[model samples]
Target chain A: MQTIQTIIGYLYYAIAAVIGIVIVANFVRSRDVRKMLLYAIVLSPFVLRVLRVK
Target chain B: MADSKGNSLVIKIVVVALWLALIIPGGRQLAAHRNYEEAVVLGPGVTEVKKLSDWAPYVANTPNDCSIYVLDSGVPGGSMLVIGGTHPEEPAGVLSAVTIVENVVPTTGKIYVAVRANRSASTVTRPGDAYPQFFNINTDFGKRTFRMGDRWSNPLDSWPDPEVYVHYPSKQLLAYMDVRNLNRTWPGRPDGMITERTTRAFIDMIKAENIDIFVDNHEAELEYSVISTIVAHQAAADVAAMASMMLSAGEFNMGMEFSPTLLHGLSHREVGDHTDAYAFEIEVPEPFLDRVRGITDEALLLEGKDEFVMRAGQAGLLYEKIDENGWNIHERVGRTNSTIDMIVQMFAMFYPDKPITYESLPMRNDIVANGLGHYLLDPAQAEADRVVYE
Candidate 1:
């Protein structure tokens, strides 16, 4: 169970990083800070899971 | 566009900050649980202290490793081992062992105590039970807090229980969760799970110390038939019976029963079978442990009072007696201590050559007069070298 939980946790982080990367790229090219920033908000759970302080 | 951009960045930062708010507090709580320590003030009787790893190397650096306080008399006599925390939910056992460690002054033989027999189990509370994170005892210095732990070994230390936990040698099927129940893992295998290894380590220490008597302290729910009883291995039957009679005559209504030969993986049965020591396990009534308990809080744990439990008792569903006064922690711990004193005396009587005598530990009335906290020494007042943490 712990192993499975760890795997799922890492998966969450992976998806969050992907979303964060796409948002950063769009923000750099289109300079549409609003859209990119809203998308970046989705990355909070991923970053927190990665940190695993909880 | 500028307003939209400002809103988006503000929202993103707010979301992240919100998560950070929750994460930091939650993380601190988890860390606090893991880092919580109970201080032990060395009693006037303590002559030496040894780590569990000194006997069994497998648990050397592990969280399961614990202290073994030796109260030696210098006078030649047999040694005895008293263990607590086998089931951390039973606070009486832990408190009784601590009282013995902090108050007993051996006059004949040595008395070895392992207050946190399963140290790893002490680090976690029962998640769904809503039990308090800690319970405090009022002392002269202030309040001394102790972690309220669960019955099973912490999953952080041992996880992913088998679908069917087959007892190693007996091969009897038990609940998968029993794999982590220290009481269910006995005469433990050296290479088995962490809990097993922890018990096995104690066995090694028991043998090396040439202990004559082995005691395991515990508290049972009033609903259980085993409550208020002294369970003895076949070898220690006489001593336990005598001890039970002695206690009942003056102290409390403690019964004596022999450990069933068919029962496997228990301290009384396994410790006696696996070692030369005469094994005995004592149980006191703890109303809070009953299924019908109400308000499972620190008050319930300490006072052992629950209207629901009393109701069950009135209905003839409880094996032990219960009333409005209830069975408080002081009563439970006092009973355990007096029982231990009786067992030691009886064991000494039968085997004069290996007498283990100790003095100054409180009994029932004394504990009632001055709560469990009175016997607990203040770490602040103790010498720096005499203070240890569990």
Candidate 2:
């Protein structure tokens, strides 16, 4: 049960990190200025979540 | 580009899951801490514990019914009533009253303290502000939890606000929702709204007990012109002036202003007009209540530090100063306690025939040094009969 719980937690984190990276990459690759800005704003909370020290 | 659509779908699913994961825990934590209760340890000075209903039976078995703590000196001279939590969001007021109830030892006259003046308000939180449900004050025993309450009576208790609230007796028009505000329903009607009934019960208590001085504790938004001042009724102008002068010399800079005669519902105006007891309302600066405040949370509520509010202060928008050190809970509570002491002293001096004296109340410097928690007692360790909930 403990191992299963640990595996589930790791899987959740991995999925979240991958999605965050993809979102950031998409924002960087976007040609339309408005779309890029929108994506950047959308991804800001994730960046804040990752960078939060406390 | 071909695989982008599939990838986007996967990412969207993951993001939603992550959002849910974050929200569920946060929501559960908030729910768990929502209904916080503070313990009031009856100190050596406390003679008896009574309910608001005991004085006026109209509020009996109601959520608005509050605890009345009596610190009676056997050799009596005069009695004073200290009301706290009329607006529960102004926590410093309530905490100061609790500190007095748990620490003060009256030597000459009696002190009546209502820690949660608007008990119904304490059960609810400010909507859409993301206000923390509870705040903890560290004490000798452990963390003492207190409810983070709203300014007005909870909607669950009082609802369906009139299109325009006309002040009873005076018939002055006020904002509709202010009907639920305990502060605005002062010198209230017995058969009116819940807030009005509560205030009526208080007035009854005052008249029945022959309270000499009535001190209403409050905190004001920094943007308000009345911030960091005492509003005293005409009858209590001399006492307020003397107290303000003495307090300014001894402690913090405090000013006194006469309550507006036209203001119908306010305690400073109505209580004095209706009753013989002198009424004075103290306003401490609270940055959290300011419109320009950033991130309304427990840390900001307790420590009172807000960069946005500080920026507003720099722009000359605030009535009171705000900086990094901020207006801390300790400082606000200290100012209030000291003001109360000064007011009581002034009252005693002005009306020597009706004297109210007390000792062992932690002073401004002491509260600032040791913090508010240092003065509060642990109710768990107190005698079973002595521990009463507000």
Candidate 3:
């Protein structure tokens, strides 16, 4: 059960990574300043999580 | 077209800079709080300090493997276990346990105090709620700081909360986040989540050590009906009722209630049902937790004063009364300490054979007078070996 929990935890990180990648891709290609600002705001959590800061 | 491209590039740079500006300090503060450790000075009463993993190995190498300070008088009587930090947001609960660890000397039987019963919960604060990462109490020596934690275990420790929490053994469905709540995971299973495993570890210790009385300390918002009360399991109802009566009649206003039979996960219910020990939970008022609270800062957390909460009281929407004085930390901790002292006395009175007695615990009047910090010993003055970090 512990092992399963650990696996699920990693799965969550993987999901977050995928979401981060999608957000980054959109952030890079989008030309709208407002949308870019929104993407950056949304992407901050992913950045922090990746850095293991929070 | 060139101007448009340059403008887009500038906007992107600004966006990136803004992201950095936000995450840099925010992330650093969170990280610092996560890693911060509070110091505990082992008083003369502390005979030995054992890890929770000593009783239950499932919690070994985990964040919830908290310290259990054993204060044994060596006299044959009864044993009691008092645990705090079950809901880490309740500072009074944690401080009350710390007071016990640093002051109380057992005269009969034994006393086991866990200042951080759910150590994993203490590692994080509620960012959405704007909870402070730490709070300091002005001690005689200087200041003693402690982590201001949340109600649930850190997501880093227990990740991917289920959509709905199905409590083990009882199969009662609860809110998803309660799976990480220590109070909601009583008599917990070893193979469960970190909080569940933490409670299970404590239960194992209780059984191993033959604890006769079990006390779980907590503080509730004025909006919560359980404030300034003792919720006792049926097994402990008599002692709790007597203690409440004595306290209300003499020291202060303290009510008593029985733990609902249907409440499957609560300490007052599960601990009594699962173990031989009588279980009781004490709750004091905390204005900081009120939905009608004002500024969410360390001052409100410790001072427990909020005009909004007082206004709520004026509207008669609160179970406990709040005034300009509010429910300060010293009062809350003092109330908790006094309640525990009353419970001990009542337990001893009821069961003469299993008597648990202790001395030097600052009572309600003493704490309300001199302040909570007066009881806290200075680690700097203590020997190097006498201090322990929680």
Candidate 4:
């Protein structure tokens, strides 16, 4: 059960990471950056996870 | 003036006035919590004081930034960190940290104490549950009052918990409200919410200071299976085993358990997994936390007695022992202080070069006999520079 839960947990983070990448990409493609800061806040947890800070 | 239209307009004004009168007083009382601060007197052993922002810039100017009281003995030795008020509802942890800062004098190593790790959480109370806004302890100087707090950080500071709170890195699903629970947000993110940022600041401080052992103080409900035990990481098993054994044999009865490998976001789990520092979480019983508790007021919080909880114990539902004597706040705080001392003592046996040594701290027996208020120093007598407000 622990292994199964871990697998699902990883999947969840992966999906979140994909969403975060898309947000950054949208900011880069669009030149309008008013909401970029809020978008960055949404991506922080996932980015920190990938960097192994958490 | 006596026309129907005039009468209707007058009635409307009177209704609005009544509504404002009813709402303004209650709103003012709740808002006053933000201004409430508990004074902490610097003990003789304290060498320096730093804010959480000194380590993490992201937490600067935020409500979660907390005071880190450092008691250095000059002689080089090991270091230990003690954090309190991770869940502000657990008053024992907060009181224990304050007692350490106000009385303890280390002789060999250094100690870092944070009286309220989640300062934002301490600014709100569960008034819906009939919790008192503040609790007072009778001291030699006068009554020392402390703000009663909730388990989660105030929504004002960290608003809008996620619908399905996911643990960072692990992504483990948790209760939505737990997003603000400092205890469940260990080793957090630099750009995360306020509670997470507070934890991230703490992790940076721990690694930068080269902390040997990290201790997180907490109080658990009597019904919780983990009560009266020291939850240690795998790396600290040997130290925890000896400490618990030594304490149980002569002093208070204590047990040790290893952190569950799968439990994410817990200090005992994440701190150990993320850093070289061994993590240990101490749990003392607080009857006021029990689901079957009575009154749910300041008296029940301090006295730790409730007929409902006793009844639950009688039915063989509680994991810890209970009786008419009841576990009071003094006993809870003393247990935390003594347990940390025991852990440091056992750690010294294994690593003498980095021995963590401290003296003049109130032990379980001392607090039980003298009461928790005996150790609280008078804020007025304290030098302005030596005092910090939580």
lDDT of each: 0.84, 0.83, 0.91, 0.84
Candidate 2 chain B, run of 10 with poorest lDDT:
B27-36
lDDT of 3 by residue, B1-390 (tens): 999989889999999998888888888899888888788999879999989999999999998888889999999899999999999999999999999999988889999999999888898888888899999999888899999999999888998999999998899999999999998998899998898898888888989998999999999988988879999999999999999999999989999999999978899999999899999999999999998788999999999889998999999999999899878899999999999999999998999999888789998899999999999999889998888888
| lDDT of candidate model 3 versus the reference | 0.91
Give per-residue CA lDDT, model 4, range B302-327, as digits (tens).
Answer: 99888999999999999998898788
The full ranking of all candidates by lDDT, starting with the best, is: 3, 4, 1, 2
Best by lDDT: 3
Q: What is every candidate's alpha-carbon RMSD to the true fold?
A: 5.4, 11.1, 1.3, 11.0
Off by over 4 Å in 1: A1-54, B1-20
Chain A TM-score for each of the predictions: 0.59, 0.67, 0.92, 0.67
Error of 4 at B147 (Å): 1.3
Cα lDDT tens digits, model 2, B1-390, are: 757866655555555566557655755554444344567779889999999999888788778888899999988699999999999999999999998998999999899999999998887776478787888888767888888889988754564466898888788899998888998988888777788889999999999999989999999999999978889999999999999988888788899999999888999998898888999999999988988788989998899999999999999998888889999999999999999999888998889998888888877899899988899888778878878766
Instruction: Tell me the spans in candidate 4 whose CA falls farther than 4 Å from its real position.
Output: A1-54, B1-8
Cα deviation of B48, candidate 3, in Å: 0.8
Would you list the clashing residue pairs of candidate 4? Answer: none
Q: Give the TM-score of chain A in candidate 4.
A: 0.67
Q: List ranges where model 3 is wrong by over 4 Å.
A: B1-6
Top-TM-score candidate index:
3
Clashing pairs in 3: none
